[model samples]
Target: MLQPRDELPSVLYSAAQVRDLDARLIAAGTAGFELMQRAAQAAWRALRRRWPQSTRVDVLAGSGNNAGDGYLLAALAQKAGWTVRVLAVGDPQRLAGDARLAFEAAQAAGVAVLPWAARTSLQGVLVDALLGTGLSGEVHSPYREAIEAINASRLPVLALDVPSGLCADSGRVLGCAVRAELTVTFIGLKLGLFSGDGPTLVGDLVFDDLRADPAILAGVPVKARRLTAAGLQALPPRQRDAHKGDFGRLLVIGGDSGTGGAALLAAQSALRCGAGLVSAATREVHVGAFLARCPELMVRGLASANQVLPLVEAADVLVVGPGLGQSAWGRSLLSVAASRSDKRQVWDADALNLLAAGVVQAPAGLVLTPHPGEAARLLGCSGAQVQADRPQAALSLAQKFAACVVLKGAGSLIATPEGELALCDHGHPAMAGAGLGDVLAGIIGALLAQGMSAQAAAHLAVWLHARAGERLGSQGRGIAASDLIAPVRELLEEHSPCLD
Candidate 1:
């Protein structure tokens, strides 16, 4: 079993950065082969602990350092009196350096080494040490065939480092990725393991630093960060003399004609998540229902676009486009919201559509929450493009608009204008319903109203919202958007309590 700290590291690194850190450690006095040996021992220990009853193992060894880890692991198993079989998928004749040494050690230990075949028999626990992060293209030829065979084997498997064939930076599959029951990664945690296809493929991931010097890591540049409670800038505890006016007022804009519920949900979420005052600007038809549903909210009927200016002037933060239809009414109101450059704002739904169409422009320092479909429209590319390289797409959106971007989906990514990226890996598939984005927008608005920076508010809000979804998601589907607000509030309090 893994501990809490093993879930993810606070800082994330690219494959190149991790490799550089490895080199740094080697230069710092630890031999490169010594590090490789430590990695093998760590993986061997974890494998044995995870499956203590099994005494027979099969290791799929390729030609890189990753294969070296597998060879050393086979040697360890052989030393432990366990039956060990090494399937040399990569030509062992081409192995060099520490890898060649490991292969020779495995051979000397009496571990049977066989050339990989299409029909290689996998026995006991299977160790996947095939393609490493250096792989840049699709899985081809014998490696692809070997990966397919590994997947075909209905046995428990442990992947060394990242799953073979997974992009170490993007978390995307390269042709095919190995599916493992448990994965033990050495040194730094790759960003790919937390996003895209990573969570499903690398189950129960654990990290071993290979005992690299802490001083060496401090000098390395991190590519991104995984948002966690400890890394956030918390909302301060309220004063004993706190009043409603202490927190900033937020306005929820949208709900054209028949879509009043979206605006109401946004407004309610803002109120629940700690906005001092919440106001809703929606169709005249929904005002009475809004008052009855959330009496604390100051709901106004916006019959004309002109009415939005008054609400805009009163709000400290504006959350736009929750059930906003693309009718003239919505466009008129969005125009008013977009024209102003003074207020902190969050744009979603129809507002995003308008921005994509070039019908409206965002004021400076705004937040954009777009799902893949909306993101494609914004980026002028296919949805597949955004999903294929989510990190790049999110950074592109942030840089293009000079605003904070929350590219929402599996492994939601938060990118800021300064080029910093944060990943939220807490959400569940059951939260994949309508209106969740509306709730998320409102929550973000509430945090901004409370005076969090665009980056801080976005990173924290995404984490809180995803956590709420995860908590309720296990109830098994049909998770309503409203179900998340209360838990989100509770979570926020725990993260940064109101009374300290």
Candidate 2:
């Protein structure tokens, strides 16, 4: 539910990638310590801008280059006539090279350097440089206590680079992580800063490239890209003489009994998103309700799987599994839909559950949208494990099924079988409601029906859905799945006008 900010770089690097980039920058004539000084300078300027009234600074320093940045910041603060304190969580004696030089600089500036203890009192705008992107294991010892104490203090904090104990690659917290009010990141933007627990804990994020040579950066492989307006491919402008048949037919299959609402949301979303022909195939029990709710839909009620074949045959894209119960009725329709391998498909809800249960093989030309739990079931692992490294889990699922996978939640991620990955950091907390997935599936199906490839459709749909939720979420709670349709339609038109 974090707010979306101005556009950042599309490419996101792993911690290893950032480290390599740093090394290359140093080897390419930028001294390592000089880069460290620039990082401190960037952080100092950001801190001053964010809290100009606060004149005191407390820097929690650890060993390694992370601490080097902290020590340098403490030096800068002291020189600026601010009361500065450096709580050394890791032994400063262990510091070497640039880190040692930074510590000496801090001492020369008369910054109060103290060995951290459980009872140490923190003041002013706290700086978390105790741990950086290199931390992959659980936080241990004094660092864990230090992080806990920082969180307990509830003081405004500015974290240098990645927050202490936050996995820079996955956005997962290692045991405990510092909750900073502002984070100043150096070099390339880390994928973790926008995904998982990152948005919640990192607070306001500010990125500085540290003036790394663009050519040196281009040589490093990017792990993923953030979804942005400029990067989105718009739907082709409608011709002066247009017909509904010009788009594509999209069939929404689901809504067993009491869950007909879910399927209705999907159908409604597709209709709003400009599908040529939108149809809903559900149990006979829900047919009247579906038609009543969305009169534009071509609604058909069925008692068995035999009734779905004709609809599946006509659809250019199929959105399956919204409100699809695990009963025989749901399975029968899913089986029939699964058989239509040539039709582009978007599978969600029970469809994903059924696929995980081995009841139906995934179809060709497919997009699977699953939340963390559903993704875990699809990958044969626990939800926690999947969430631990969402990027890898998403990639694994895509490779296993040879389909485009949209792993939805906090920072929704889209991955393809070819190992391409993209992340969407646009959304709001009010979006935490039921039937949203169904709406999302329909949006994707509508995009596919409009002739977009699965990857492109997913990227656009995910971004649009999240952005719509974000806009509506600003009004505060009570956001229904149906509520997102109009906004989504409006957003689509804005992104791609009908005439031009």
Candidate 3:
């Protein structure tokens, strides 16, 4: 049986892994049909609780175990006096094993079973069971048509155990995926639910263990983890006797000429994130603006990489590439920063592009923050490719550069050189503006300066950044890059307080 919860579980597994876990549970004495029945009961309870007033259900079932779950759910609804109809998209006669038993049960329960037609009129809540985590590649006919109908119906929908046509391993939509109002998943939480397109289409995710024994699941390693503030153990509070020198020195290099605002945003973010000392090496014209905007920053005008050497040598941590153009000046600054191996580095924006172009190399303690476009360049693939499997792209970047990688977008992911991944399901659509990446770079730099490992810094910075965006996203759009700074600072303090 699945337990009710306000939030999803932290651990995640691929579709194949979840299936294997199911088999393992069955092998461990839990009968396959018993698990299916439990899943149906759990999903039925969840559906009734969520849509209590709706006594009508339209279940779209296939011929697999996914369909079996749906058939059982329909049976439960029918027995409970709900007007339930099981629309068989695939031939019901082809159902075998537990799925066959489920169909028989639904029939015995007197649930209205009908073959789905392209022009089928839908009523009440929609149950999407056309496909499950077993699907990959493009969605084929009838199933595709069914998914389209479910999406186009404009009715509230509940998908059973991973939305039909959604790749459970990558979160990629197979041609098209069902957009459900709620998804009741069984056994293990699918990684796809928190990666790629999963979060957007999954709506509210509910998980049930199906009463799988803890010992049965003890040996399977998780595919990834969902990063949250509650899961992160923040830094210890600052000592009462702490001084300016107790923190860290952070240097930001960018602002080639016209885009000084990007570099400035990074510097401002670093200061706000608690860097003891923050400096900027940008165009001379931008120096006055930096001073006026943040007197705390040690601003220096620089034309070439040589000019930045002095400051780069002095900083404890370096944040490079915000507003850095592809021109020679921007290249020089990155080259100079890349030249040093002594300081930890956070690279973003043009820095990432330049790295992708092979202009500079990432150091040992490097943290690269690249959006889909930049990530595509690094992986030699398209933005769609990067997005289709964000976890793979992020992990590839980390492994390629031997650094921690933050692949930022809807579901931001942080991957380390060792292939460990943490995903942030936070953040808002309002973050689709400029200067945000620069701010994120600075935040990561600040965390690195504060003695956090590159991997830890990237995860913590992403969590804080996304959480801040989510809070501001509720207030409507027009969220500026700088608008995130104070909120992130506040979040950091709330989670990782300065006071003991």
Highest lDDT scorer: 2
For model 1, the stretches where C-alpha displacement exceeds 4 angstroms are: 5-7
The deviation in Å at residue 263 for candidate 2 is 0.7
The positional error of residue 201 in candidate 2, measured at the CA in angstroms, is 1.0
Q: Regarding lDDT, does 2 or 3 come out ahead?
A: 2
**Would you give me the overall lDDT of model 3?**
0.90
Q: What TM-score would candidate 3 get against the native?
A: 0.98
lDDT (tens digit, per residue) of candidate 2 on 109-178: 9999999999999999999999888787999998999999999998999999999999999999899999
Scored by lDDT, model 2 comes in at 0.93
- In order, candidate lDDTs are 0.91, 0.93, 0.90
lDDT of 3 by residue, 242-358 (tens): 876767999999998799999999999999988889999999989999999889899999867788888988899999999889999998888888888888999899998999899
Q: Which rank order by TM-score, best down to worst?
A: 2, 1, 3
